[model samples]
Target chain A: MVVDKMLYNLGRYVNLLRDAIARPEKFSMYYKETMRQMDAIGVGSVFIVLLISVFIGMVTAVQFVDQLGDSFVPSYYIGYIVRDITIIEMAPTITCLVLAGKVGSNLAAEIGGMRQKEHIDAMEIMGVNTAAYLIMPKIIAAVVVIPMLVAIAAFVSIVGGYVSTVLPGSLSHTEYVLGLRSFFVPRYVFMMFVKAAVFAYLITSVSCYMGYYAKGGSIELGEASTNAVVVSSVLILVFDFLIALLLT
Target chain B: MIRTENITKTFGDNDVLKGISTEFYAGKPNLIIGSSGAGKTVLLKLLIGLFKPTSGKVYYDDVDLFSVDDDALREVRMKLGMLFQGNALFDSMTVGENIRFPMDMFTNRTLGEKEKRVDECLEMVNMEGINDRFPSEVSGGMQKRVGIARAMVLEPKYLFCDEPNSGLDPKTAILIDELICDLTNRNNITTVINTHDMNSVMGIGDNIVLLKDGHLVWQGDKSQVLESEEAVLQDFIFASPFLRRLREDALKQRHAHD
Candidate 1:
């Protein structure tokens, strides 16, 4: 029964995406909305993304240094480990997970509030395609902006590794820099971007779907917001695994 | 003009609207009045094509509403306007922007032209200036007026209002009724209003449809309301003791005169 329900929702969610991506009634209106969403989703999220990335890099460096002590592995391997983990895993996955909580819940609450207030119905009666007008800009903005945020997270995490290891006299600056420059696979960057874009799409689309079909009053709106975050987070993890399998 | 034929709506095992047919005409306030759970809102939504009936045909003049393709439905909807029960003005937009939004979406008019139309709509609703204020900055009555302004910004051919007077004081409710009545007459547009307010019924109800438990119990105008002997109508309109006593006094006066 649960599988059946999930399949039904998946079909509905795909149909909604098709409707939402239809040509806009007015290009300028859509552009303006997209710009607003970009500012809200991208610019509003930088501080927290930066804060988390720094901590992740610091923790990974210190833990690896302790594990490699008195072992055959060189101390500089900490830089290489931090760089690859930050780029391929921590940056895309953790940033999107955080965004699923912040932006996903926010999008759900905003759209669900509009539904409960009858704003969507009013726009529909006015001949506006409510689905396209409300959801498309959000999806487009997130797809464009989240990858950039993940890139920034990768760079900041590398800097955090240098700060935690080199500055603390555990590894020389020159040795750490050599480790960072050593196994530079361009395909890993491609893999990182793929994960970022896929995770971005999953989070925004899932959140918007939950909100668009929201019914009832304040309690129902809260439930929709919660569902948006939970579903998007779970989908992010699932897609993360799939993208790693396919792209690698 | 809008007309429905044998409309029925069923949700699960609950039938919210039994086979009911009605007409809403142009240039008058056509009121749908009934008690709670009388299916007034469901019927209104069906009329607006928001909810499809289980079986029925709704015609806007000669166009069958439920029988059209998506593009045709959108074209038809462009001629329609609705004011929701909660006065669903966009909270993020200022008063001016809310009124200008439909124009922005549908019309190719220049900014100057759209701004001029926005001003005209605000003036029609007697809310001159204060265009930059967001919806949250306004009172409930002001928000209702803004909703009306937004609905009429396009000069729509058909206007539907759902419980327009629900949260207003009696005086403000009467004013809103008068405003809607005046707009319907001035535009010569088909206007349908769903309400349970007796004041609105008495003030602007050129035609009224009464429903009870999904059944169309009676249909009449304000003039006929006092004289009709329909038990459901009497029980609904004169539900309170004070209003029932007033009805008895009016009957006694009429009897003495006769």
Candidate 2:
């Protein structure tokens, strides 16, 4: 029964996306909505993304340094480990997981509220395609902005490692800088962007689907918001594993 | 004109609208009234093509609503407007922006032209100026009026209102009814309203259809409501004890005069 319900929902979600990508009624209107979403999703999320990313790098640096005690591995391996880990996993995955909670839940609640209030119906009656108008701009904005955020997260996390290590006198600044420059692969950067884009699409689309079909009242809206975050987080982790398996 | 041919709607195991046929004419306030569980809303949604009937068909004049392609259906919908039970005004926008939305989406009108049309619609609803205020800042009656203004801003050929006076004082409810009635007559648009307000029924109900458990049990104008012998109609319209006593007293006084 659970599998059947999941399949049904998956089918419906695909169909909704098909409808959501249709030609917009007016280019100007769609452009305006897209710009608004860019501001909300991109500009509004920078602070939280930066905060979480810095902490992720700090924790990784501190923990790895302690674990390296008496080991033959060079102390500067901490910088190399932090750089590679942030690029390969922490930057895209952790940043998006945070966004799934913040931006994803918010998208679900906003759209669910509109559905409950019949604003979507009002737009439909006006011959404006409601799904396309509401969902497409959000998707577009997220796709464009989330990768940039992940890039910033990657940079900030490396800086955080430097601050935690170099400023604490545990590791020499020259050694940490040497470790940062050592063995950097350009392909890993490519992998990071790919993961960022895929995760961004998953979070926004899943949240939007939850919201678009939300029924009943306030309780249902709350459920939709929670489901959006939960479902998107799970999908991100699952895809993270899959991408790691396929890419590495 | 809009007509439904034995339309039916079912949700899972529950059937909301049974096989029922009805017609709403243009240039009149066609009211649909029923108790809480009746199929009035389902039927209204079917007419607007929001819900596809499980069995039957809905026709906007000669065009079958469900039979048309998406593009064709959208073309038909462009001529339509609706006022929701909760007014459904965009909370983020000012009154002028909300009214200008449909125009902005569908027309190539200049900003000046759109502003002129917005003012005209607000004036038609007797809510001139105050264009910069948000919906939350307005009173309930004013919100309903602004909703009406937004719905009519597109100058649609058909207007559907779901409970236009659901939450309002009795005096304000009558005023809204009169305003809707006046607009319907002036525009000669096909206006269908779903309402449970008795004052609205007797005041502007040019044509009324009553539904009970998805069946069209009664149909008539306001004049026939007082004389209606249909038990369902009487039970619904005079549900309150005070109205029933009033009805009985009026009948007794009429017999005494005779």
Candidate 3:
């Protein structure tokens, strides 16, 4: 019974996305909405992403320093480890996981509110494709902007590693820099962006789906928002593993 | 005109609308009225293609609403405008933006032209200016007016209002009814209103369909209301003892005068 219900929902979700990912009625209207979404999803999330990324780097460097005590592994390996972990995994995965909580829930609530308030019905009556108008721009904005955020997270985490280690005199500046310079693979950056894009798609599409078909009242809307975040977070992790396995 | 032929709807085991056939003529305000759970809303939604009937057909003029393709349905929908019970104005947008949204989505009209039409719609609703105000900043009555303005902004040929007077002062409700009546007559448009407000029923119900327990029990104009011998209509419109006494007194007076 549970599997049947899941399949039913999956079918509905796919149909809803099929409607949403159609050719837009007008370019200018979609462009204007996409830019607004870009501002909200990209610019609005910068501070939290930056704050979390900094802490992520700091904790990684500090923990590595403690573990490397009196070991034959050189001190600079801290920089190498932090740089690789951040680039290969932490930046895209952690940043997007946090965004799933923040932006995903918000998107779900917004669309769900519209549904409850009859705005979607009104638009449908007006000949506007409600699914396309509501969801497409959000998807576009997240796709375009989330990868950029992931890139910034990568850079910031490395800087955080430098600040935590070299500034505290736990490791010399030159050694840390040397460690960062070593074992730098361009393919890892490509993998980070690929993960970022895939996660962005997952978070936005799932959240929009939760909101679009949401029924009942405020309680249902709250559940939809919670589901958006939880579902997106889980999907992000699952996809992260899949992408890592495929790309590696 | 819009016509439904034996339309019915069922949700789970509950049959909300049981085989209703009716016609809503243009150039007048057609009303769907009934007691709570009478399937008035369900019938209205069916007429508008928002809900598909279990076994029936809806014809918008000559076009079958259910048999049409999506593009054809969309083409039909382009001529439709609806005012929801909650008004359904976008809270984030100014009144002007809400009004212009349909035009923005479907038309290539210039901004100047769209603004002019927006102002004209607002004026038609007797709410000139106030375009910059968000929906949250306005009173409930003002929101209804804004909703009407947005609905009529595209000059739709078919207008559907679901309980347009649901939460408003009597005076405001009358004003809205009058505005809707005038617009219907002036534009020769099909206006279908689902309402339970007695003032609206007796005031502007050019044609009325009454539903009871998913069956359309009575159909007539306001003039036929007091004179009709349908027990269901009698019990519905004069459910209160005071009103029933008044109805009996009026009937006696009419007979005596005759």
Per-model lDDT:
0.93, 0.93, 0.93
**lDDT score at residue B253, model 3, on the 0-100 scale:** 96
Per-residue lDDT tens digits for candidate 1, residues B33-122, read 899999999999999899999999999999999999877888999999899999999988999999999999999999999999999999
**How many clashes in each candidate?**
0, 0, 0
- lDDT of each residue in A174-221, candidate 3, tens digit only: 999999999899999999999999999999999999999899999999
By DockQ rank, best first, the candidates go 1, 3, 2
- Cα lDDT of model 1 overall? 0.93
| Runs with alpha carbons beyond 4 Å of true place in candidate 2 | B248-258
Rank the models by TM-score, top first. Answer: 3, 1, 2
Tens digits of per-residue lDDT for model 2, B80-122: 9899999999999999999999999999999999999999999
**For model 3, how does the per-residue alpha-carbon lDDT over B1-258 read when each residue is reduced to its tens digit?**
999999889999999988899999999999999999999888888877778899999999999999998778888999998999999999899999999999999999999999999999999999998999999999998999999999998888999999999889999999999999999999999999999988888899899999999998899999889899999988888889999898899989999999
TM-score of chain B of each: 0.98, 0.97, 0.98
Report the Cα lDDT for residue A233, model 1.
97
For all the predictions, what are the DockQ values? 0.88, 0.82, 0.85
User: Model 1: which residue pairs collide?
Assistant: none
lDDT of 2 by residue, A132-234 (tens): 9999999999999999999999999999988998899878899788888999999999999999999999999999999999999999999999999999999
Q: What is the C-alpha RMSD of each candidate to the true structure, in Å?
A: 1.2, 1.6, 0.9
